[model samples]
Target: MGLKYIEPIKSIVLLLLVLLSITFTLSIWTYTPRLDPIEQSPTVDISIGQRKNVKEIIKPYKFMIKNDEFMRGTTEQLDIDQIVNEMATWKITQLLRNPVEMNKKQMNEFFRQQNQFTLYFQGDVPLSVYDEILEIEEVNIPQFSFDRLVVKWNPKDISFEVHFLNRASGIHYYGRVTPIDTMKSYRSLVVGSEAYKNYAEVLQPDGTYLAVSNESLTIQKLTYFQEELSPTRFRDALFNDPNAVRRSQVDATHEEFGDDHASMIVDTDLKMLNFVHPAAETSESIKPSELLIDVIDSINEHGGWTNTYRFSHINPSYRYVKFQLFTEGYPVHSNAKETTEIAQFYGDDRVFRYIRPYYMLDDPLSEEVELPSGVSVANALMNSDQLDFGTVEEISVGYMMRHDPEQRVYVMEPSWFYLVKGNKNWKQYTPEQDGGEQYGLE
Candidate 1:
C-alpha cells in the first residue's frame, strides 16, 4: 500500500510537470511585438533669416461684448430672414448627412445632396465655410435654428435663434455672436456659440441644468400602422355611433384651452388609440441601436421617406421610442401619440400602432415663434402656481400639439418644456399672445 501511494504521488508530480511545460511553451509562443528603434533625425540649426515661412493668421473677427454677446455685426437688413433660412436649411442638410456627436439618427437613409455649393455668406462678413463644428471632433447640428430671425440696430447684433429643425419643435435656443477667429468659417449663427452653449436644463431657483432635446428617452415610436386615413376614419373605427362616443373620441376630453397631447388614431384592430403615455416598463430594456435598425428598415419599406419622419422622443429606458412624421421639417405632433403601451408590436420590441394624420402637399411650418429668453422663461416657470418647486432637472424646446379646429388637425408650435425631477409629465410654459407685443422679438 505504501508503494502504491508513492507511485500515485509520482504520477501527480509528472502531471504538474506537464502543465508547467505547457505553460512555458505558451509563454514562448505568445507574440509580443517590439517597437522599432526610433531613428534619430539630425536637427538642422537655423538662424532667424533661415526660418520657415509663417503664414500670417488673420483673425477675421474678434469676440468683444458690446451687449454681453460673443460677436455682433450689421447685415444691411437685406433679406436676413431669407439668408438665415437658407443657412438653416443648409444646416438641416448637414445634419442629415452628419449628426452631432451623441445625437441619435433614427433613420439610416443617406440624405443625397441635390445642389452643389462653393461658398455662402451671411452679409458683409465673409463667414468661414467649414465642413464641421464640434464639441470634441464631430460636427454638432442640434445647436442651430432659423425659426425665429431678428435683425437689430444700435448694438448691431443679428439674432438667429438656433433650434433643432426636425418635425418636432426643438429646444428654445440662446443667442450669441460668432467667434472672431472662427468668423472665416462660421456661417450665420445665433444659437451654437462657442462661448455659450444653448441651455437645455430646467430652470431652478438656484440656476439652470443643461438638457438636450431628447435624452434618456426610454420610449420610441418606431414605424406606425398606416392603414388608410379619412375624416370619419377615426369615427368608423371607434364606434358604430358618431354622436357621443365619436365626439368624445375625436376631441380632447381634458383640454379646454390649447391642444392637448390627446389625439385619436385608428389602430389595426380598428379601434381609436387616444394619445396616452405608454405604461412604464412594459418590457425589459433593449438595445436602441438594434431598435433603430428596424425603424429605418420599416421606414424604407414603407415606400421610403414617403413622409419625412423625425424622432419626437427616442426614450429607450423602458425600451420604447417614438417618431413623428415631419412635413418640411415641421414635426407632426399629434400624428403619433404615445399609445404604445397598449398598441400592437411587430414582434418583441417593434411598435406598429400610431395615428396617421392626413399628409398635405403644402405642409409648411405651422407657426414662426419668437421665443422668450431662457431667463424670461425661467421667470415664468417660477411664477407658475400649478408646478411645484420640485427638483427640476431638464428643460427642452420642442413642438407640442395646438388644436387647429379649422383644419380639424393638430398643428405643432414651439413651446418650452420643464421636466421636474422624477416626473415624466413635462410642465409646459407657452407664451400667451394677448395681442400685446412680446418683448425680445424683432
Candidate 2:
C-alpha cells in the first residue's frame, strides 16, 4: 500500500512543475513593462509680423467730393477714414448692373454731378469682399468689382445712391442707400468740399478722368528706420513641415531653403524673400474675389503684414496680387523692381509664389522734405516726350524708396507716377526721366 501512494504523489508534483515552467516561458515572450510616454517634436507658432484686417489693408487712398460749384479731392488718411466710417453705417440694397448705356462723355457728366462723393482705390476691389466693411443687404449680389465708389445724394428722393465703377472694364453697379439718414453724412462731406483744396478733373484721352490739384501742392518726404527680419521665422511660418527644410548658403548675400515640395530664397542684400510651392500649382483660374480673400487670409495666418501695406494691384487672369507699402496716405514704390511690395500668385487654392521684403519699418526720421505739387506733376506728365499722353490712364503722388546701406534706413522721396494702359505699369516721372521743369521746391 505505501509504494502505490508514493508513485502517485511523484507524478502529481512533476505535472505541476511542467505547468509552472510553461507559464513562465509565455510571460517572458508577451510581457510589457510600464514605460514612459514617447516624446514628440514640439510645435511652436512663429509670428514675424502683425496681422491686419481687410478694412485696414484695403483702404481708399484718394477721394473726391463734388458739389454744384466745384470739386475737391484729397489723399489725406483722416478724410478717407471719416468717409469710410460714415458709409459703413448705412444699409445698401438694390444692387444691380447699370442697364443704361453711357459713353465716356455721359459717364463724365454723371460723375461730375453735384452732391457727389467718390472714393478711389488703387486696385479692383471685389464688391463682395468690400461688403465685409460695407453694409450690403443679403441678396443675389453680382460677382463684380470696383476701383471707385460714387455716392450721390438724391434730394428729390431724400435718399442716397451708390455707384460701383470698374474703370478698367467699365462694369457699373448701382445700389440704393438706406436708413434715409446716411444722406446727412454724405451731404455734409459734399457740402464741406469748399474747405478742401480744389482739384481739377481732367479727362484723359482714354476717356477716363484724372484729378489734379489746380495749384502746386506740397507733400512730405519721409525716412524710415528699417530692420531685417529673421529667415527662420519665415521658414517656420510659411512651410507646412518646417523641420524637414534644409538650408544652404547660395552665396554671400543669398540663402536658399527648401524641402521636398517647396523652396524659399532669401536675398540678404535686398532684404527680400521669394518663396515657391510647386505642389500648390493649379492651372484653373480662381475668381478675383476668392483670390483676394485667400491672399489676405494666408498672410494673416502667419501675421505677415510687416509694414503698412495697402492693396495696390491684382491681375486675376494670372492669379497675381500685390500689396505695396504705404506711408502718410501715399503709396511707396521701390527703386528695386518688385521689392517694396508683397506679391503673390495663387494656385490650387494655395500660395504658389510669394515675394516680399523681409524688412519692417521701425520709425520715421524727424527730417521732413516738401514734395512737388500735383499741378507740376501733371504738367510734367503731359509734356513728357517719353510718355504717350493718349495711353496715360492716371497720375498720382507716391514715394520712391531709396535704401541706405550704411545708415540702414530707407529714404522715401515723394514723386509722381503715371499709369499707362496695356501693361498697366506705373512709370515714375522725374526731371531727368520726363525732361520737364524741376518739381521740387527750392
Candidate lDDT values, in order: 0.33, 0.80
The candidate maximizing lDDT is 2
Per-residue accuracy of model 1 over 1-442 as CA lDDT, tens digit each: 7887998899999999999999999988996879999999995321111111101011111111112332322111223223333443333221232233211122101111111111111111101112122111124433222211222212233322222222123222223322323332233333323233222334345433222321221111222223333434333332323343323342442211112222344332322333322321145554444443444443333222324443333344444444444332222333233221112122243333333333322333333455555555655555556455445544444345444434544345565555565444454556652222222210
Q: What are the runs in model 1 whose C-alpha is more than 4 Å off?
A: 1-286, 304-307, 314-319, 325-361, 364-371, 396-398, 403-414, 431-442
Where does candidate 1 have its weakest 10-residue lDDT segment? 53-62
| Residue-by-residue lDDT tens digits, candidate 2, 1-442 | 8997998999999999999999999999999999899999796867678888999989998888776778788887888888788788888888878776567667766776787778888888988889989889957567788888998876566578889987656678888887546557645566555667788866566666667766555777677786878988999998989899999999999999999999999999889899999988877877888899999999998999888899978888888989978888888876534377899998786899999888878768745555566667777677777666777667787888888888878888877777776654566778675665433210
lDDT score, candidate 1 = 0.33
